[model samples]
Target chain A: MANPSNNYYDLYRHGSLGVALTDALDELIGQERIDPQLAMKVLTQFDRVIAETLQEKVKARLTFKGSLDTYRFCDEVWTFLIRNVTFKLDNGGQMVNADKVKIVSCSSKKNEEK
Target chain B: MSNTTVGPVYDTIIAEVINAVRVDFEENGVDDGALEDLKKEWQHKLSQMKVAQFPWDPKPEPQAPPAPAHAQPTAPPPTAPPTAATYTQSTLSPQSAQQTLSLPGGLLPNANPMGIKPEPGFVQAEPAIKQEPGMQPIHPGYNPANGARPTAAQRAALALESQYGQRAAASINAIHSGMQINPAAQPQQVPRPGQAPQQHMNPQQQYRQGVAASMQQRMQQVPGARPPNGLPAAQLDGLNDATDTASGPGAVHPIMMDRAQIDEHLHAQIAARAKQMEGGGLMLPLKEATKNRSLPEKPRKADGPSQLDGLDDDVKSEEDDEDAINSDLDDPDEGGDDDEDDDETMGHMMLCMYDKVQRVKNKWKCILKDGVLTVNGKEYVFHKATGEYEW
Candidate 1:
């Protein structure tokens, strides 16, 4: 009868949080006009966003105040993000493929001294 | 009945009767023409009866001789006790004859209630009473409540029963607590044939205690332990999902199809892609057969994008790119199929691809601001709480 603050345990039992987060992030990334690489860095910093969100939701009482990568405890945050955020795109919008953005590397031309 | 009616009303009544007859004939399988003739005959008889004036009285039909009526009931004289005289008289009573009626060749219940005027010699056949196969007839009269209620003596017995149960429970508890060490001591005294040597006991006990202590510590840490920390509740689902790959075909997530789309787009960019698979509707079985056919990969020389044919060719190329990539993938032995390889690389290329896509789709700020964002041509209208928009 004890409901854990994050209910990560129940979420794990019922569904895969990682798959869910991957799905949510795919939708979020697809809709953004920003560079895909930067979008990823933002998603990687989800712990910070989660911590801030939880602080707001809980009014700072149940704080997930911990360092990035150190909060082995924030698995619940990942679970919460996945369960609450992952969604299908409107009008059947799809995950943006990195291949869609072809990387065309060009070297700068130097002025020739004649 | 007055016979003054001589108008459309008579026609209406006749029509209604005809309709009713038709419906009854359809429903009940009676001939309408025959019933109509019978109705006419009945009407003719009624008219004659009316002319003759209603008969005041009718005579009752003659009755058959009521076979010797059974003897009347008489109260049995109460005797001092069951004596020989009363027993002999009881056997000769008319009630004893009634009991004999239950035997074979005796009266059976009516077989057909619908049949009228049954023949005298007709014998009723009893319906077969079907007993459920392999099932016993449960005695409906049996009651569990009868056993539940206890007399004084029964209560005393129950008290003894509880006393014994408590004694047994206490004995079990004592053994569990190591109070009764008879089983343990016997091992040392008798040196049982398959028992481990006593020298190993101390180490084994220490190892068991270590295991138990570790398990208890884990149970306590589990609540606070973060995800992937080996906590029972940790969100190690990513690890779990990696283990299962042989799931059904449809089990591949829709996201995987999007991954496939990368291959699609790459193939579309290729100019020399050909339309291998047919596009229009075909019989389902034929289409399925075509899908199954393992046609050898057609080797096409790669030409530059300038080889693109026409305006329609652009659209066709875009659609066929996916098929081209897939066909290219179909034969991995060929050095070609770089398009598909590019698709496989897309996952690593965009790290936060999924996360970014999710955020873009989500109108979080709008929800936070309690407003909406309208996207127009080259402009974003941000409507706030005041119901106004700004670029």
Candidate 2:
């Protein structure tokens, strides 16, 4: 019953775990193993669960600094292409470095609907 | 701090999403086994993405559960191609049957429809050189246009048979001819070709010419009212056409010969157009549009440019934007679906929710939370992230 309007963003479906789940569901549909309507129901549930899990379960923090290459804010999503980025994980002081990184961030206000 | 955290985090998301959708699976009447398969297949695909270390990766149990589901996905693709191939063969069968019907000899029970007609001119068979064999195929092809009309039950039968081959049309015609009124025609027709193939081809031709020449002589004599000697004008016209094609030697009677030519011409044209419609016609308009762009312009101008776009772009585009007669429909794409650009690149991305985002001129800062960051072939999971950058 929780659709896109009242529920969490389906935006994360573009992520790796979501993409993998979608591919799996598509294979099931292609085999006539599951109806396509059921696959959509599963995806809607995935949007709620992944958003809830990430907000509640995760605790570690990281800081990153970069020269932003391109930035666009359209609809409720903010997209940034950053160059020469450096990340410092607060847990153990480990550093991950990259030449370029693209950040896609959604509005946290939408998820705090509870 | 490390890629190790991603393994358990992803495992949690996977288990949670699956548990949530379980009731939906039940309501949809999908088996619990499909739910089980979805989990295994999901993990299998995620592992294939190799985006991070996962709890399922080190153990052999992860590989064990997906083998059955993996094999299932592979099986249907092979079956899919055969279905498409058989579809093409069915659609082409009728046309192929029509083509064979048109050819000259090796006439067996092949022209059963023609043979069933008990064609009187067919009585002078003599291998049916020119006009007769054309009658052979044209008659069978005629069945399709005919087949489209029959009673609903016959239509259903023809439609089903039409899938396998057009040979079904011939068999259906044989059934149709034997049904009620014409039941007597087939019996005498069946064995007559053996004895009748050598009969004289003279009586029909001589009679037709006798009528026409006598009409001509009478036309000169009377000069006021010319009659076909009681023969219909259509019959007289047919015999005149017959005199031209057979040249009085091809063992074809005048009446049957002219009608066959007319049917042959119509069937050939209709068959050629049908073939074109099936083959290149689908994507043809684009090709024709590109090749003959000037063709419609001429007729359109002569008939009246009342058909949209009267004013040329070079002359009148600046008068109004809405009235601009643009030649190409290169309108800008509606909305931004721009994020997919990252999918084509080497993976180094983070997807998150921003708690607070601020901008001062080009300087920007954002507090992002509950994020998945994948960079340098490693995935990092975090509850909160702070990013500062200048654009």
TM-score of chain B of each: 0.11, 0.29
Query: What is the interface root-mean-square deviation of candidate 2?
Result: 1.3
lDDT of 2 by residue, A1-114 (tens): 455524688777878888889999999999998999889888888888878788888888999999887788999889888888999889877788888888888999977674
Whole-model lDDT per candidate? 0.24, 0.56
The DockQ-derived docking category for candidate 1 is: incorrect
Q: Lowest summed-lDDT stretch of 10 residues in model 1 chain A? A: A105-114
DockQ of structure 1: 0.01
- Number of the top lDDT candidate: 2
Q: Which stretches of candidate 2 lie over 4 Å from their true place?
A: A1-6, B59-346
- For model 2, residues B10-124, the per-residue Cα lDDT tens digits are 8998998888888888888889999999999999888877767788887542433444443222122222322221122223232322333343432332333333223222222
Provide the RMSD of all predictions against the true structure, rounded to 1 decimal: 41.8, 21.3
Q: What is the C-alpha lDDT profile of model 1 across B241-276, one tens digit per residue?
A: 111211222124444755665454445433222333
Summarize candidate 1's per-residue lDDT along A1-114 as a digit string, tens digits: 012222211211111112233344344346542235533332333322222222232210100111111001132121111111111112233211111211111111110110
Model 2 residue B225 CA deviation (Å) reads 77
Q: For model 1, what is the error of residue B121's alpha carbon versus the real structure, in angstroms, after optimal superposition? A: 99
